[model samples]
Target: MITEPARGSTVTQTIDNDTADMSDVEAGAFADYVPSSELQKVLTEAVSLLGGSERPGQVAMAAAVEQSLRSDGKLAVQAGTGTGKSLGYLLPALLYCLHEDARVVISTATLALQNQIITKDAPLAVEAVKNVTDSELRVEVLKGWQNYVCLHKLNGGYEGSEDDLFSTMEDSLAPGAGGGGEAASGRGTKTARQMRGFAAETKKLYEWARETTTGDRDEAPRGISARAWRQVSLSSLECVGEKCPFRSECFQVSARDKAAQAQVVVTNHAMIGLEAAGKQNPLPPCEAIIVDEAHELDERVRSQASTEFSANMLATCAKAAGNLGVSGSEELSQQAIMLGVALQNLEDSRLTQMPEAVAECRTLALPPLKAALTELSAKSGSDAGSDGEKHADAAKTAVAKAALTSLLDTLETMTPESVANGETILWLSRGRDGDQEPRLYTAPLDVAGKLANRLWSEHAIIATSATLKLGGTFAPLIHKMGLQLEEPQPETLDVGSPFRHDRQGILYLARDLPAPTRGEHPEVFWDRLVELVEASGGGALGLFSSRKMAERAGEVLRERTDLSIMVQGEDSMAALVNDMREDTSACLMGTLSLWQGVDLPGNTCRLVLIDRIPFPVPSDPVIEARCAAVKRAGGSDFMEVSLTHAALLLAQGTGRLLRSAADRGVVAVLDSRLATARYGGFLRASLPPLWPTEDAQVVLDALRRLHQKVS
Candidate 1:
């Protein structure tokens, strides 16, 4: 068994080739590996399909993938913008899988990437690879159950008084912008089919999906609601596996089984976190795991492993338990009632606060659960009970006891001193799914520790992503994932970018601009923004860190110019993309959703506007705890980690400027920190090598010149 190294002991290798030691690695170990000319042809085809030219970064990514497969040692490659990093990695991964017959799992940060891979990129790459590889490589996309619509929940409807609640939801969703029953566009154009019974539609599609060759969600002609998807979904902890009535034909199970049989599997970070934590074993063990948009891995892991208890969930569980036969008996049933009432009383009292409620819930909950378990155990062992009766009694007792004990233990471990001074939380809540039950719970700020301990320790794991590096190095990132660097120096390489950032784009910082106050409107910034947009001639993307900010900016732009302004939350992401693509002189103002994963080459997005540096909220429980934890551990959490995390995200944000060698644009960041702060240099270094300037006119002129060239 391999033991994890002591914290802060691992060192990351410098990007330069000046000091790397070649003694440990064989010089020609990968000499037999040659870049497939056929794979190169496919990449060329992809570039042509997008009407863009390939850059150096894309070429290097392709090379790195080819080499990493042969060596099998861990490899991290940073491919800057226009690298076609997705296709770069895809080409080699496909070629190698075909040759070695090894399964490969490709994981990404967002649903957008997963969609692209399953719907667009994967198919395109496969079509190109098929011409040369002489073998068909099977690929599939697997997501958490909650992402799919549930046939049972949709058809059966909800159990309680959800009829009225669901009726309101249905009515609200019925009419779109154009007075149509379907989700309509501004012009009254409906984007999809009319609403149907969620369970029936979900199950029908799921059944049809089984018979179809590709199980991609994009195959569905109409869009589905996120809320509707949650009804039929099951997470790792909630899944009962083979015992499920739909086990033989389960969509999730079939997806996993197919992944095991296929050569390549496309999945997301949350599922990967579960896989890394050994929570659910879906895909077969593979030689490598490729993580796309890798920067979000830490946060994604935290989200999946963390537990959330609402006042509602607790109340529902209490009510559900009461309805169960456990409370049908005389004495134990009375104890169960007392237990539920006490829990509810606590929830109603000073326990409205999450921390206090978590503490009190543990105290009130354990004793009753223990008493009920004792009673149930006694009944199960009685001579008067039949075999089936005994089994049922025992099963109920075991589940209640196990769940109560686990929750109690978790709450007890989450002390204010531990959480407030660290990066974890023990949250208490008061709400359930369309019911009035409340629950109490605790969760961790980071799931890397759990994941590393449970899965990576015993497995030869491969985690890959495009935007993993934040501050020129991977040190800040690996720490969040609960993995330390190996030896005094860990391997590092920048295969170099295919796109010429210095030539294709410029980075403009809005220095001397006043910081935004809480109540301020866009009027203060709109004058300068209009001038910039006019200079760019409307081919721009304004990215705001907040949705409120994005909407305000959109309002101002709408009032100021003839340019088309499409803001997020105004419509679906698909609608926004379509609008941006149709009009060359259009501006798309959006929040974090458009920060990364947006791909538009040439004139469509010639100017990128960053409203602010995306920073984790100071009052956020997880971020606050993590910062304090770093401080307690004898480190400066702000400068050492948090800022670095922000820088990486900023890099990802700025990278949206250029997607091909011929793609030219100016990335304008409203935050002065990219120019003024002492740490500004650090953030700038993380971005592509763009020519930095503070002159607004210069940036405007550049945008004009670029737009003219494209037009």
Candidate 2:
């Protein structure tokens, strides 16, 4: 694995060499080859059929993608919103798959984008390519095993320990005296009610499983809990492979088979992360990878690689072992109690060093846990019995083995050697309520090494996102992704947005407002915010740094203005965005999620209000450790970790203003730091090059005029 350079280090590489002036002999080589004419024709046709006109930026991106794929080099393209980025990459990918007879995997950050590509964009690209090459392309969606319903579990072939636990409780409560007694008052009544709900949900899932051919949980009835889904689905670890009687009809197996036959496979980042971690290869082999929303790849990979342990998890493992008839199960339960007690004695914070309590728990629990896992692993699926009985036994043993293996892994991660070497960072966290039990979490200090050795080294990569470049360069994100260590360093391109940013929008920095402090913003900030919203006639999207600020802004605005005000937590984000789109004069206030993927065009959104710079909390475990690492490496942690994060989010929040060529609005930043800080220029360069001004009146006048025209 390639070790990453120090954070904020300047690692530069030249752009892809222009082939226009090269001789035919030199350019004919794969490295210097230009995009084929066929690529342009297919892309043009795809755009035309999608009801869009030609975009220079999209064409440029497509050409770069084609060159990268043909030469087997890494490329990072920042195709701004409305530049038709999806089609730009999809067209080249489809063409490559058809002509080369090779496969390509397209990984996205969200399921919504996956669905959009599979249902809408992929079909259009296929049709466009078919029209040109007279050949067809096949696309498939591949997800984790847990996403599909396991016929073995749904068909009553596997009764897990959870069912046994519930049964024990019901039997224990069965001896209650006549109806309407103490049994109907408190705990008993609540248990009965919960049991009914669980049964109802499980029954519904069974019915749906019979009717739905795909067996995907995403297609199941809405409002199903994760607990209910677990009853019918199997994790990768819980699958019994060929031992299951339902293997012939398993949805997950069928999906994998389909992916093997597909020319293009669409999956999420988590699946890629799992593969990169050497956990499992859920996807088939592919020649190239296209990571859309590539900015989110690092964090998603980190989340998948991270693991947590709690008393409840230990209890679950103990129950599974007990159900599997393993020895030492009782000792495991005792160790769980001891561990819970030790956790309660410690506070919730990042552990700079290993705690004695944790070490003691590990030393005591390791033996029993290992012994149970050994016995469970020794159990065989091939026993002298009926096929039905053997199938059920195999499934139950798989679940027990998986649970014990996960518990053992968590214990191994807590070793002092792992924590002391700086390979991992450990922390303790809990639920929102104080009474909730604390859980221990351990994550890799850096995922760059893993990603370098596993992903970039193995495939030709084309990573694209609107916000990949930070502080006017792609070096920061590239270095973070470990792409800088690749043999032929990735080429970077910025196909600017199709929208005329300077003509259609204004970046309003509130220079006169007081510098924001820790707690609440000054009343003057609220006053200025109201002024901007009123100027835009209430067509405003407020992106705050925290939920408290967003909710407070919503409350104050509803009282101060006559227009409609919708808070994010008031309803579902989809419903809230739809309402904001339908009601022209309504103002929507939200944090984090609203910064990206909230697309409202034309009159529905005339202004955007940013409360302050969205910076990562310094006390966060991962952020804190990363900053210390940079500091130790003689680098500026603020620049490498904090400022870059803020810039990306600020850019995303700013981009929410313009969704189309016709969009016209003002992005109003209430914080004065953007104009006063020394790093202000760098942050400004990260954003769209809008017509900028420090005066609030200039923005107000522009908004009022735009609002008047729309009205």
Candidate 3:
């Protein structure tokens, strides 16, 4: 095979390669699905139609899900990469919703996964079910109401900053622009060229929203920023549902209505947590719940259940009340300013305890605002007018009411008793820039009890992910997730991956390098990494420990090598991934999100470089508090929390190497801790059974041979 170096990226490979072969895998002990059963036939047909091979691990996971539905059993299963886990659980979900007369809800981690299930997997699964059962299936995808475009907010129905609403996307996204982090201080902004570019881009969004079937942000065309999208989007606080003039054409309402009739509803983890935590009930009732990408469930739940109090939100509240023509708004506005001042002072001082100024603001400043909002909410749109006018007025009032209610909830979380009881943690979380006003945050330190009450009690529950077991066991995840807090605990199963990891992948630990230290210079890391990427001919996905490391590596590589190099946040994530796929020699370097969801199978990705172990920040309040609590309860804080978290992330990072059974690659861990530390054994056990090697020459030789074959 003839290979060439990338023009600037120094990547040494050509773009052409063969498509990955994904065939059916051998069945294991999980073959006990009722033969000739409606569920079985539909699943069989769906696999056949997917134009891929069946995997035993997939079948095993599906059987677990189906059985849980058949009985009332709860299940926790781990299906590794290339196991076709999505279809494994989805086919049964569809069969149950259609054949067994059950309602099923599938919640995932990211919006992309939600769409993939609803748009790609669900359609194929439905067709397969139709073929076998001769039944029409109803599947709907639902996100939070805020995820949809609010007709009122888009058309200047709100009372605040509509004239300059999107004057500068930079201002809107600036530290304090919309009143969240810092007051929109108009500090540093962009060029006239950039603003013109933004104007054209946002105009495209307006046109697309009118013509597009789904007004969801994911459906938007390329180059549209979040700041631009938020102009057309709605939050619960800003929406007046059922009162807007364009309710008939509302994307959010339509989606919810469709979900009401759907037998199967696909959503993400955050929406499910909100539905359970809040009384509003965003979704219809479901008899069965299936959570995919179950690894991130804890973090999503924490975020959904938490709320932050900031000056910007307070400013919005005051404006919403004044729009109702409230008489007391003059005093309320003054109090809102005081509240903002108190917040700024509290954050600036960096004190842990609640200050007197903040307490007074909450007591004296907040009550009048609440009263004004309530009065307006109670009599909103009462002035006699045409139906259209009244509807718009009511929508505005709804927006005010939503904000008022949310503020009260935020207040409750920050109250002394709530913070003292240990059920919730109230702390001041600073911004990326220390000078920004610190927002008061209230988050659940643990959601176990809440899940026990609202989640574990479901009729049937199935949780599956590529990396669920913390360290060779499901006990940690199950216990922490509150999956076993109720009667009839879930049955645990491990459906191993179909890929021959032992032969197809290598775990190359760079023992010659020194351990990664926070303050130490990383010249050694760059030297080893650049050499490895050159040897592999540029099919590498580099996962770094921090943004600084990623930047240094990216800069050094781009300056020294001729390979195509892409860094995170430099462009939209979608564009970077597309460029990498098109330019095979390109090396995509980033942290976090890229670890798991990225899929560049076969020759396009043959090398993965992990800068270091992904341990939680030592200063993170939440993780530190949890670890302390575990230590107090007679558990090893390092083992139960720190090591466990790092192990799961390492498994996820390493799993990126061999995405298909036919794919062969190497995962190089630049950190020497995996070889020197004692707990390394546990982490290694949690990963796939990749062949181990320490010699750089061995890996370089293997990469060359694989690169030749692909060429």
Candidates' lDDT values, in order?
Answer: 0.61, 0.82, 0.74
Candidate 1 overall lDDT versus native: 0.61
The runs of at least 3 residues in candidate 2 whose Cα sits more than 4 Å from the true structure, single-residue gaps closed, are: 1-34, 163-207
Q: Candidate 3, residues 1-711: lDDT per residue as tens digits?
A: 112222222121111123332333456456564433666677789888987656667777777788888787789999888787888887888877766677888999977788888789889988998888788789898888767777666676664534221222233433544442333333323345677887898898888877777777777887887767766776665566556777798888889889989989998888778865754667788898888988888878888888777655666666666777764556656766876677665543223356677676666655676677668766764767987677667666666677667776777667655555555666675566664455777777778777778877865888889888876888888877789797777898888877666557777878888998886447877888888888887888989878887887788889879998888889888888888888778899999878878888767889999999998885676776677668878999888888888988898889888777667788999988887788877888788877676767777777776767756
Scanning candidate 1 in windows of ten residues, the lowest lDDT window is 9-18
- Compose the digit string of candidate 2's lDDT tens values, residues 1-711: 112222222211000111112111112222332457999789778977978776777777888999888888899999887877888898999988888898999999977788889899889989999998898999999998899998888777777434322112223322343357664677577878988998998888778988889999889996677878887887787788888887898899999999999999999999888877778677999999999999888888888888887766676677877877887678778877987888888888888777787777778778988998788777854485888778878877887777777778778867877777667889887654543557789888888778889889888899999898888999888887888889888998887777666667778888889999999999999999999999889889999999999999999998899999999999888889999999999999999999987889878987999999888999999999889889989999999999998998999999998887677788998988898888887898899877677767667777777777778
TM-score for each predicted model, relative to the true structure:
0.74, 0.89, 0.89
Top candidate when judged by lDDT against the true structure: 2
Worst 10 residues of 3 by lDDT: 8-17
State the lDDT of candidate 1 residue by residue for 388-442, as single tens digits.
4443443344344434433434445555565554445643334323233433444
How many collisions per candidate? 31, 0, 14
